[model samples]
Target: MSRKHQWRGMMGDVAEKCGTTVAIALMEKLGGAHFVVPKTYTNRGPMAKLGRELAEPFIAEYAGQVVDIPSKLATKRPPPESRFQEVEALIDKNYTAAQVAAELGISQAYVFKIRKAAGAPKISSKVDKRQKSLFD
Candidate 1:
């Protein structure tokens, strides 16, 4: 696939797993925004591309550093964006994306979107639609 196509595909897989809109998640993910837990994708191609993108900012700093040190401080580091941190904190002990939206007072669709964008699977063991609110 073309490079753009690869990024798009990787972005798609990320969108599918993290449960947030593709655009939102991709911006956070590709823009070097970090998360409490780095998301991984089932598809390798896209994942590799994203990994490279993420590493670009760090390559220069760590160019000749010891194994323990990163070449540089990643362009963005020390606590990634909080976009998904709230939701991540609400995940079940099993690391499942359960009861996040209800707890955060956000749309379940958005919750699902973020989780999927974070690399959650289609077959989440999570309880879907149970967190719905009248105001949603």
Candidate 2:
């Protein structure tokens, strides 16, 4: 059988024994690694990283077995243009460049670039000398 078939079979077994949620968590966490499920769940074991609740079912079914999880589970990124549009929309809503960058997981510089490209006014950080302080 092909490696893909083997991977599917292993994942199916995990899903059947541990439920789909555990199977997916295993795939996401242990993908591309030959991970051995311990016979007994331990806080110090490799499965400990998954936390007890998520690790127990997998250990019950796959104890002492080395699972070869595929590496194709990486999340796909949205297109660059779509991301740019998202930045643009956030800027239009008057979100600060830092806020836009944090919300979109992009750099502040990239947010500034998008703001400039959209012809949005730059947000100033300097305090006005003549402005009265709220605490005064």
Candidate 3:
């Protein structure tokens, strides 16, 4: 499929999963000031082609009224308190942050935050001054 077609298909899937109103809200959120069409579509004009097709449903629903979708609307709740201990245990078991985050339905950045807050040791490979240098 063409890239444009793939994008439209993905958007359709999003619409199907979240309902038209939510899909439109999500589109507007991603579109910013342009709103109806996303930047990628506008940048090259392919998205602009489907502008009317996409907008009709949303326009009819809103009756030309302007509305805002709250930025703070939470899609999913924060990982449970026990998740912190789980994160620590997983780290002890050598689980990567990405793995922990995936299992916990949270972001990898959040996993790092939990680790930092828990005083976990940094997992880095810094060359120690006492170690013999390859150049030496």
Instruction: Please name the candidate that would achieve the greatest lDDT relative to the true structure.
Output: 2
lDDT of 1 at 67: 24
C-alpha lDDT score of every prediction, in listed order: 0.43, 0.68, 0.51
Model 2, which residues run further than 4 Å from truth? 1-7, 72-136
For model 1, residues 22-85, the per-residue Cα lDDT tens digits are 3343364445433322233323433343464443333332333322211122222232234566
Model 3 lDDT per residue over 1-136, tens place: 2123222333445455435554555555444233333323233432343365554454445433343332322333343343578887776666777888888787798787776766666644323345697887
Better of 2 and 3 by TM-score: 2
What is the per-residue lDDT of model 2 for residues 1-136, given as tens digits with 9 covering 90 to 100? 1123233446766767677777677767776678777899888856876789999988888888877765444223232344667876765676777898899887797667655665655657434445699998
Please identify model 1 stretches exceeding 4 Å from their true place: 1-82, 93-98, 122-136
- Tell how far residue 124 is off in model 2, in angstroms: 68
**Clashing residue pairs in candidate 2, if any?**
none
Against the hidden true structure, what lDDT does model 2 obtain?
A: 0.68
The 10-residue segment with the lowest total lDDT in model 3 = 1-10
State candidate 1's TM-score: 0.26
Which of candidates 1 and 3 is the stronger one according to lDDT? 3
